[model samples]
Target chain A: MKRFIGFIRKEFYHIFRDRRSLFILFGMPIAQILLFGFAITNEINNVNIAILDHSKDTSTLEIINKISNSKYFSIKQIISREAEIESVFQKGKIKAVLNFEKDFGRNLIKKKSAQIQIITDATDPNTANSITNYINAILQNYLQEKNKSIQLDYQIIPQTRMVYNQELKSVFLFVPGVMTIILMLVSAMMTSISITREKELGTMEILLVSPLKPFQVIIGKVVPYIFLSIINAAVIVLLSIFIFKMPVEGSLILLGAESVLFIITSLALGILISTISDTQQSAMMISLMGLMLPVILLSGFIFPISSMPAPLQVISNIIPAKWFIIIIKGIMLKGVGLAFVWKETLILIGMTVFFIAVSVKKYKIRLD
Target chain B: MKNENVIEVENLTKAFGAFKAVNAISFEVKKGEIFGFLGANGAGKTTAIKMLIGISHPTSGKAKVVDFDVYTQPEAIKRNIGYMSQRFALYDDLTVQENINFFGGIYGLSRKAIRQKSKDSLVELGMHEISSKLVGSLPLGWKQKLSFSVALLHEPKIVFLDEPTGGVDPITRRQFWEMIYKAADQGTTIFVTTHYMDEAEYCDRVSIMVEGKIEALDTPKNLKQQFKVASMNEVFLKLARNIE
Candidate 1:
């Protein structure tokens, strides 16, 4: 135990003394959280649009007034000719164009239906989709307000509610993902690089030839990183809660316990990487290419796993990050306790045990 | 009971598939003598040293290090041996005192004992003033000297120095040999591998290896006289040429 403690102290020295690692350990978490929180949002505000009102009628003018009044759209230009809409979109300055059909108010009165064409630039498909949806909702709301006093014979209403994130804040989704990415990178990449550093600097040769057991050396190299990763987890959790107003509705203790398990899982992966790679550079490449890419692309951090192709969904089931994200997002968003997350918790535990077992078996006792 | 010879091997071989890296060769070293392991590159001097130091297994052989069987009692063998590798083996980012303490701790030394040895080693190297300096900032010669001293901090029965003097200047190499001699005089066996033939002349007995086989093993003087060469360098060249 004393030997292990001493070894951990030396590891701390290596981590603290190196500037690049220190920045990656602390600077990256806060920077990533802030960048993801304030920047890289999907929500739209004050989109630039043009209007082509051909009817020149009271209802069309009233509808145009309602559209411009909403915070989502700003009336940039009022075009009279139909030929000019294409040229205006060709400039690419406007994201959407609203066109009112001829005799819109007369058709509404005669047939109880009117046409309003919404032409959006699909160059950015997501923004264009959002523009169309927002316009549709506004028109629906305008009709409802207009028919407040009169009673319709039959009406069908569809009600939609965003359950976990009511505001549809993009950062709420990103907070969980960024937290996973930071933990995986810090825990796995940092530990792998450190272990391979001993190999690169010839310190591992000295270590292997000494009285230290293989388990002792590996655990000693990992303890400090486990502590650091927990701190990173806490920093991310606290940042999301305090700065981003992300709620932690479940038991905080369970959240803490589950996070520590994931950190150990990542550390086991790190040891596995170090065993296969002989140099720090190869270890780093493996950690980044082998670990980081999967966590980001397949873990459902940014993309939904259910919507992915069948083969990729099968592959994602094996990634520990996918289950971890599911667990934490459940705890934070749905306010669930152990009974709700036990299956995911078991998956993480099983992966941790499997990784630790395999890496220990692969750990070499001799230089060969 | 104690034995006079600290290392014993018979028909020790290390092979990679069909090719033998260390052929069936054997030798013994006395308790308190310097054994020089010389070889051209890829001659398997390193592979043999690795086995003796308990970090590599021999393919098919019988070997004992400090009375511990190489196969069955490797852990016991590890506790009684110190190793300094060809690569600079000290933590460059750690201070002199910290490196000493760390090595001492791994060898299961007491805290008070590590402190005492750290002080003594720093003083003996005449580096007491730089005890707090990072090893990487020091010159190459100083790092090598410090590495040798750290390897000996646990007072193991034998110290394996693998190319400890490579790339060092002649004056520093002389100082290093003086340190080795002083340790041997105090009864610590020295097993060193080096490329410099002149350094081999300083060993009590030298063995030259060629193509995974020891071609000659004798005192440097006798080996030179038998080969009819003027120096150890000429002797080495003649032996290497004959092998081709």
Candidate 2:
């Protein structure tokens, strides 16, 4: 027990003495949460738009005033000619244009129909789609209010409610994914680099020849990283809660337990990577390229796995982060219990065991 | 089978898929003797040492190190023996005192004993003032000596030095040999491998290996007389030239 404690102390010293790694260990989580929460958002606000009103009548003016009053759109310019619309779009500041056709009020009152064109910049297709949808929703609400007294022949209303995140806050989606990524990168990448450093420095031979068992050495090297990654997980969660007002509706103890399990899964992957790599550079490269990219891109962190092609969705099942993200989202957002996320939790546990078993087998084979 | 011998081997071999790295060979070393293991680059010196140190298992062989069988009692062998690799294995990021403390602790020494020993060893080397310095900042000669001292910290029965003095100045090499002799004098057996023929002259007995086989084993004077040469260097050349 004393020996193990000494080994852990040495590992702590190694981590604390390196200033750059220390910064990365503690600083990355808070920075990523803030960046993802505030900067990279899908919610639309104060989008610059132009209105081309050919009729210049009370009805067109009323619709224009309604659009401009909403928080989603800001009228930047009143385009006079059709030529001015293209020029304004070319300036790149205007996100969309609202054009009312000639005699729109007459058509609306007499024929109960009118034409309005919502031309949006499709270069950024996601924002363009969102902008068009928001405008359509606003127009539909206006039409309902204007036609409340008139009885229509057929009317179908679709009522929708967002269950987990009522506000559709993008931060709710990012906090869990970012937390998983941070934990994975810190635990797996750091441990692999540290193990391969000993190999490169030739200190691994001395360690192998020592009285310490191979398993003890590996466990000793990994324990410190587990502590560090857990602390980072806590910091990320707290920041998300305090700064972004994201809620953790489930039991905090279960959340902590799940985070630690994911941390262990990542550490086991680190051990496997170190066994395959002989140098720190190769270990780092393998962890980043083979692990990080897939976790970020294919684990439904940034892009939904269901929307991906069939094969990619199938491939995403192998990424451990996919299960973790689902588990975290279920617990934090949906306020679900173990009964809800037990399958994902079991999958994570199974993967952790498999990774550790394979790494141990590889390490034993290497000793001979 | 003699009780006086610390290391014994008979027909020891290691094969990597039909390519035999260390072919069948046999030798013995008495306790407290400086046995010099000399070989060419691919002559399997490292492979043999690895098996004897209990890091690598032999394919077919009978070997005993420090009264423990290599196949059955690798843990016992590891506990009873010490090894200094060619790279002078020491953690560069650790302080000099921390390295000693770590190795001593793993060897099951108590905290108070490690502190005392660390102080004594540093004082002996006249490096007590720099015990807190990072090992990476130390000079090559100081690091090599520190590594040797750490390997001997547990007072193991046998110490294996694999090319301990590969790239050092002659003065440092001489000092290193002086330390080796001091250890041997105190009843710790020294099994060393080296590429320098001059270092061969310092050993109590030397063996020359060529193509995974020991071609000659004798005192330096006898080897010179048998090969009809003036020095161990010429003797090594004569034996190397005769390889078919």
**Whose lDDT is greatest here?**
2
**Inter-residue clash pairs, candidate 2:** none
Q: Taking the tens digit of each residue's C-alpha lDDT, what string does model 1 give over B1-244?
A: 2238999888899998999999987898888889999999999998999888878888998999999999888899999988999999899999998999899999999999998988898898999999999998999999999999989999988999999999999999999999999988888999999999999999999989899998999999999999998899999999999989
Report DockQ per prediction, comma-separated.
Answer: 0.80, 0.82
**Candidate 1: misplaced stretches above 4 Å?**
A55-66, A103-113, A140-165, A365-368, B1-3
Off by over 4 Å in 2: A55-62, A102-115, A140-168, B1-3
- Whole-model alpha-carbon lDDT for candidate 1: 0.89
- Where does candidate 1 clash, by residue pair? none
Q: Give the per-residue lDDT of model 2 (tens digit) for B145-238.
A: 8999999998998999999997888999998999999999999999999999999999999988888888899999999999889999999999
Residue-level lDDT tens digits of model 2 in A73-154: 9999998889898899999999999999999988788767788899999999978977877777677667777778654322
Docking category of candidate 1: medium
